[model samples]
Target: MTTVQSARGPLDTADLGRVLMHEHVFVLTPDSQRQWSDEWDEEEQVANAIVKLNELAAQGISTIADPTVDGLGRDVARIARIQAEVDLNIIVATGVYTYCDVPNFFAFRGPGIIPGLDDPMVDFFVRDLEEGVRGTAVRAAFLKCAIDHHGLTPGVERVLRAEAAAHLRTGAPIMVHTHPGTQTGLEVMRVLGEEGVAFERVILAHSGDSTDAEHLGSLAEAGFLLGMDRFGIDATLDFESRVAIVVELCRRGFSGQMVLAQDAACYIDWIDPMFKGALPNWNYLHVLGDVVPALLERGVTESQVDEMLVGNPRRYFGG
Candidate 1:
């Protein structure tokens, strides 16, 4: 079995104080430096992340969980550096991302004609969790997976199976990325249930995109953590719409089952080119500092914010 440890040493979740459940420190596209164009560089990326972390710490955020899975260029060593520099608890994740984003090898030949919960790949996840990620002293505290917007693709389904097996072997919580406004969360929960995984050990990401109260309420009632992150992506839906879904969920007494984040990163060219004239817009901390406080002003209670930002994440990450 894979036994995971916190990267920031031992932590008391009760004193986790305030936390940001999902955010990325450094994110790189597949083509490496070439993919980033003129605005991307390692040093600049790290510096921007540090500034954001400091800003979040000042705003009462004591911990952060960066769910940058394997295909996402999750740099645990750099994360460790940021943690030490900022003195904020940062938790890193280990596991494969969505099949589309993963390398061709993972999607093609492997165990069970897909990335099954068997053999070498399973060994890979187990080793990373038991030892450390990429030979760094840092370790992963959670496992991350993703389901496509339309539901589980063949590649995605295989990844899910691998995740399930990893969960059974490691006892690490699984965080799943689902499509916005889709019923993918339910499908993910169904698969996990079939694999004999407990709902409490899984977090349904992007649950906020779906405003279906009954669906979200059902997931909460089923004992799963609902992640309503993606706070800064205004292109798809505005913050108010997303906050409304969360507020409605809170009203339905599902506050304790929710986790919040602004899944923003410092990929300069990835965002709309018009913003900052192609410079990296790693200003998610600004959103947390502004939007979350706005939610408070609009009657989202401090206790509710605490549940979404702090308490729920501690429980979800099994801190």
Candidate 2:
């Protein structure tokens, strides 16, 4: 059986039961928070995440693939702290997150500075996968990069290419934060395809944000696993539309090519605390609490849900 790295340590893929393909224990802008936010309490945040994750484990979601990477302030040590308290497995990612520009850390150090020079991010990502992240001994289990409405800007392409190169070096899978409304997954299919990343080795995340079943179906047919993740963020798309897309895709016999998640984070500094009140259901429990019940009502079978929640993730981890 194949094994994948978790925040607690490595685990057999089969042990990753009823997986949520996307979720973040924390998502923050570290430098900004440290400089400006008084609400950034480390101890409290960790404690709160433990409580919430324990609640998630109670729902039978034994694993969550957290794609919080460099730009989003990923701290493996903090994750280890929470993983220690919870019954669930937290699989972290390694890659850069950028919709437009590469992080300043990567700006001038790579090939764009001068041709034929290898991009350092590929080695950095590979090291996080092979070795452990920043000496935390919590190795990353997957790669994450994004292509948003900004499209594949030069910086975005660089990060995506590095993730692809790292995937070639290591068999660990990839998760691309795609803006399906922009049809960015197609761009990913082209870029990653040219880089020799097999479609099965990648997940097109945030596919649920789009109501375009035809667009999602094409990607599934192309062999990429779709993350009908983001079940609770109804602000972008209403609850009914999100459920409808998943139902439609499953109707077309693409359940095996999909994975489910809420894309919720315990403490995200991205939104204003006042405004965060708008998304009440955008928490860890939305999938179990609401989405699944709605799906079953709409004719998505128990086995289809199992394929999306269990079988697909196991296969993605190479189980």
Candidate 3:
């Protein structure tokens, strides 16, 4: 059986039904939360995450592929605590999420500064996939990294290569935070391809942020799983445009190459709370409660939606 690691334990890939490919239990700045925020209650946040995730499970979502890695405040122990209560699977990742510089911890240790040393990130990420996260037995099911509008800077290149290497080592799939606006997915294809990583093994996240179906179609044609995720984060691409793109892609017969998600977190302190309140539909429920219905109304078939939600993810995980 093709088994993907979950927070609870190993899960047969066939059991990963109706997955949200990109979601976070929490997206935090640990330093900011520790020193600046006055309202972070540990127990309350855990309880809140439990509530949010359970509600997602009630929607018939069998799994959530959380890409919350090192830079995104990945607290697997706390996630483990929350998973004990939720009914669905929470498959976590291992990688650095940096658009620019590598974290100080890795700054001078890798080849970036040392010139001839192996990237410690590869070992660390491999350990997470092979051994377990930190000291827990919950192995990471996938690898994650990013390249934004900043393009392939040295730091971003470092993390991407490390993640690609880890994938080649462990056979874990990778999700890259890409900027479709800058046509960054093309750069991602070039980079990971050079590292000998197959395009099918990589997910170009946030491809839905741009409505340029030609660019997205090219990436999909190239065998990259387009993450038509980020539904409900309307400031970049509004609800109608996001749903319309999916319908358009499905019409073009690329439903098998797309995946859906809200990319929602229970509490992400990135935006001001006041600003976050403006994104009324930016939650775990928005994709199913709103986007899916919208896609159906726009003439996308239920089978196509299932292909995106179930088949694509299962294939990506080697089910």
Candidate 4:
């Protein structure tokens, strides 16, 4: 049986039931927070995360694929701490997160920047997938990167190429944060396809944000897994529209090509606390409490929901 790495340890893929394919334990910019934010209380935050995750577990979600990697402020040890107090499987990831440029750590180095150098991120990503992240036993089970409305800039291309290289070496699946409004998923297919990465193994995250079923269906036809993730963030598309798209896709017979999630986090330092209040339903429980019922009411079958919530993720992880 294939095994997937969890925050606590390795688990057989069969055990990853009803997974939220995208979620984060925490989203922080440690440098910025240290310099200017006082909203963070480490002990309290960790306890709060424990409460949140356990509550999710009680709702019958067996696992969550957290894409909080380097650019998103991933802390493996902190995840391990949270996992210790919760039974839910937390599958973490590796790779950078940026819409335009690679992080400055990668800026001056790497292949084209220097005459004889190789890109270091590929090695780092593969190491996380095969070995362990930062010497911790919490190995990354997948690779993550992003291309946004900014399109594929030099740095975005670098990160995608590196993630593709790592996927080639380790057979790990990939998840890309794409801006569907700009149809950037096509660029991902062209680039990663060039690297010989399998389309089925890559997830086009935030696919639900765009209600164009034809645009989404084309990607599914190309064999890429569609992440109907980002359920709670209604600022982009409202709740009814989000549920409607999934119903239409399921009707069109692409249920096996999709996965679901809220893209929620226990705490995110990106938004101002005052502004965060406007998104009352943007939390970890949105999918279980709201989206699923809506999908059912819209005539999405139980089997289709199971495919998106369970079987698809199992296959994505090589179950």
Q: Note each model's CA RMSD in angstroms.
A: 3.2, 0.8, 0.8, 1.0
lDDT ranking, best first: 2, 4, 3, 1
Q: Between prediction 1 and prediction 3, which has the larger lDDT?
A: 3
TM-score of each: 0.88, 0.99, 0.99, 0.98
Q: In order, what lDDT does every prediction score? A: 0.74, 0.93, 0.92, 0.93
Better of 1 and 4 by TM-score: 4
Candidate 4: give the clashing pairs: none
Per-residue CA lDDT of candidate 4, range 1-319, in tens? 8899998889999989999999999999999999997999999999999999999999999999999988888899899888889979999999999998888898888775884578999899988888898858889999999999999998899899999988989999999999999999999999998999889999999999999999999999999999999998988899989999999999999999999999999899999888998888899889989999999988998999999999999999999
Q: 1 or 4, which is superior by lDDT?
A: 4
Clashing pairs in 3: none
Off by over 4 Å in 3: none
Alpha-carbon runs more than 4 Å astray in model 4? none
TM-score of 3: 0.99
Poorest lDDT segment (10 consecutive residues) of candidate 4? 109-118
Say what the RMSD of model 2 is. Answer: 0.8
